[model samples]
Target: MRAVVLETAGPAPHLRDAVLPDPQPAPDEALLRVTACGFSHHDALIMEGTLRRGVTLPRVPGHEVTGVVCGVGDGVPASLIGTEAVVVPGDIGHRRDGGFAEMLTAPVASLVPLPQGMAATGGALLASPIGVALRALEACGVAGGETLVVTGASGGVGAHAAQAAHAMGASVIGITGSPEKAQRLEGKPWLDAVLLDDEPWEEVVAALTGDMGADVALDTTGTSLGRLAAAMRHGGRIALVGQTSPDAAPFAPAEAIFRELTLVGSLGVERRHVERALSLVAGGQVTPLVHEELPLSVESVTRAYRAVKRREVLGRVVLRPVGF
Candidate 1:
């Protein structure tokens, strides 16, 4: 197996390709022949040594993995062989060896089979940000005919949240910092409006909702909690889904109490959420935005990490193994 290993963590981490023995599945695990893996900000944080708690050194860091099941160990069904699957990179990339290689192992319970002919590139993104978005929308309890505000709507998770909320019959408002990005979000049929982050977003939302305020808000930027609360109707729900900001947003407890607003913090998603997200992608109800596809190698992997670190890449950046 060829893998990229981060032998040490620092402000500048080193990556090298090493040939190692192929991983064998545990009794309850499946061996995956990695087809595509997506680079995430989590990977960049690990490389920069900004996120090192519970991290094991000399790691292969890639969690957004999509691949085929080549073999299954004991307690697994043989029928899974040759089936295309997406592995929920459950702490695999962060705490253990992950799918930055030609092969990796995942628990059978963590593998979601892909619909026939569905691209693994999309599958690679389904279980993470996509699933997270679904969970956040659910937490917000977005309903038909309601107004849903999606902060950081041009981002990976935010875009999917907007699409999901729109599909659920909510009128979606997207908030983005870049006008060009907002234009792209506006072009989507699912979005009802796009607001620049620098604008008076609360006033805009109030006007859009006819002064009633938005019914639900998904804050992907993490810096908009206060703004989300302000733009939301009384008894509305706000789902906090990201930590992009280094500092927490100032909260007005009295306002939250007076309005009876519900603030929910959403973290990782469950397996069922991943399954639903995958079905949506497989059915073409929502498309995960893919920025670029690069072949898996030391150079490509390093470049992808750099792009993610610089926050220059839009959508998911996928890496295909050599043969793929």
Candidate 2:
């Protein structure tokens, strides 16, 4: 098995490509011939040495994995062989080796079979940003005909959240720090408006909604809790979905008190959420969220790290193993 290892973590993290023995499945696990893996900010953080908890050096750090089940261990059904699936990275990428190689093993319970004809590249991200997006919307309790604001709307999770909310009949407003990204999210059939983050975007939202503010706020950037609260109408709910930074978010307790605002923190996803994400794709409810795909190599991984750090990536960055 050929793999890329994070040999060291620093301003310039060292990456080494090595050939390792193929992983064997445990009693409750399935051996996966990995096809595609989403390179998430979580993976980038681990490689950049910013996030250290549950991570060690020289690790294989890819969690959003899509692969084919080549074999299954005891307690697993043999009929599952040759099934294309997406693995929910439970403790795999963080606590142990993950899907950064040609082959990996995932617990059978974490595997979600792909719908009939879903491509491996697109299926790779169903568990993370897509499933995570749906979970956030459920946490916020967004309903049809409501005004929903999505911060960092060009991002992986935020982009999907905006589309899914739009599909659910909500009027969507998107916020992006990058002008280029703003253009990409603007004028979309799924998005009603796009706001640049150069100014206090909460004010823009207030103006756009005739001073009533948005009915729901989805905050993908963890640092903008206070701003999101300010952009919401009374009794509006805010779902904090993604954390780009480790710092404590600035929030106004007064808004939650006098304004009767609801704040909810959401992370990870359940099997039902993944199933919903797949359904959305299969039904064409959401337009294709094209990812920036690169082949697996030290150079490509480093390139991806820089793009994510600069917040330039529009959607998820996917990495494909050699031989596709």
Candidate 3:
């Protein structure tokens, strides 16, 4: 089968054609023909050798995968054949070869049936970034009518979280670095306000809530964007989901203690959150903002990774492994 193989980990991965033995599904597994896969910054981190511990070499890195079940192993239900599904990217890309290929073999338990209206591109993203957003909100205990702030709101996870919070009746405030991105959310019903990341965050906060500040803040910037941390109201909850800036300084302990804040760390979307995200997409309660779709050829995969590393694209980048 044709797959993007990572023979060595470095600043970049080698995208090439290599012949491999056909995978034999285990008794509880299903063989899937991959249709689409979502590319994330974490994939780049894995390639660059700077991620969580215990990452092994020569591994397939994609986790956000969507495809159709073609074959099932013993002990797997026969009913899943011909069904569209997405494989959950489990445990931070561990113990599994990912979806960036012509075919994938994953446990049947990890498969989620794709809803009728969910597109392949959207399906692939739902299991990862969207799941993270939903889990973040749940962790922070956000509720309707409460104000929530989303830093890096233009990114994949941020956009989905903003919409989910909005759907839950929270007043959503999105923070972005570009006016063009701020303009993209103009007609979005979920957003109560949008602010530029470069502006004075305090002033923006005062204007949004008459100086009360946000009830919850989800930071995806990975950096200690002081404004986001400062805009939280007393007793506000914060969920840290990403580290765009790995070397960022810690948030002020004194400030957090004085405000009686709840700061929680979130990573990897669990099975339950992935199910909720899929259901939301299936019901059309939320739509993923897919920015680009590239062919699954070797060259295309390399180009897509470069674009992601350079931060040249907005929203999600999907790879079409099978022509539609």
Candidate 4:
């Protein structure tokens, strides 16, 4: 098997490919032939040492995994063999070997069967941008006829959140720091409006909502909470995700108290969320936002990481063990 590992993680990290023997599955696990895996901004953060907890050096860092089961260990079902599925990340990518290799093993219980016709690239993101976005939406109690704001709208979770919110009959305002991203979101049917992050986005959100303010917000950029709260209607809910932004978002405790806003921190996807993501993809409610797919290699992974760090990627950059 060929695998990519983070040989060193620091300000200037080192990553390279290696030739290794295929891993054998545990008694309760299944061995999969890797298909597609997403290169998440989370992966980039680990690579840059911005996030170090639970990560070990010389590790395989891809968690957004999808593959075909080729063999099952003792006590596992043979029916699982040849089943296409997505690995629900627990210890796989963060604490153990992951999908960067052409083959990897995962607990059979952690695999979610992929729906027919969902491409491997899209399946790879079921547990990530799609599922994570849905989880955030659920946290915020998104509903039809409501106004919703999606921060970092061009990125994976934000983009999918905007789409799912729109599909649920909400009016979505997608805000992005890049004008290029604003332009990109404008052409999509998911968003009612697109606002540049440089603009007074709060004012725009207020104006767009006719001063009633957004009924709910999906805060992908964990920075700038005070402004986010200001744009929300009193009693509105805000679902805050990971630290996607470099700068800190100034928070106002008084404002949140006075507004009686509900703030919930959302992270990681459940098995149910992954299933819902599959349903959404099957129904065309949400398009898997794959920026591009690169073949598994050291140079390809490096290029994808650079693109993610620059915020140049719209959605996710996926990698395939085999060329498409």
Cα lDDT, all candidates: 0.84, 0.86, 0.80, 0.89
lDDT string, candidate 2, 1-324, tens digits: 899888888778888888888888999999999898888888888887887877876788888889999989999999999999998777767777777788899989999999888988889878887898999999999999999999889888899999899999999999889888888777788889898887788888999899998999899988788888888899999998877887977887887787799889997888899889889988988654755888988777888889999998988888899753
The numbered model that scores best in lDDT is 4
The Cα error of candidate 4 at residue 102, in Å, is: 0.3
lDDT of 1 by residue, 184-223 (tens): 6677987899999888989999999999998888998778
Clashes of each: 0, 0, 2, 2
Pairs clashing within candidate 3: 222-243, 222-244
TM-score between candidate 1 and the true structure: 0.94
- In terms of lDDT, which candidate is stronger, 2 or 3? 2
Model 3 C-alpha lDDT per residue in residues 1-324, reported as the tens digit of each score: 777776677765555555566667889999988888988877777767667466665666688898899889999988899888888776425446777778889889888888776789988888878998999889899999999999888888888999899888999888887787788767778778888877886578767887877889998886644566678789999988887755975567776777788899887787899899977877778888788988876676677778767666567889887552
Model 2 ranges with Cα > 4 A deviation: 247-249
Pairwise lDDT winner, candidates 1 and 4: 4
Model 3 worst lDDT window (10 residues)? 88-97
Q: What is the lDDT of residue 32 in candidate 2?
A: 93
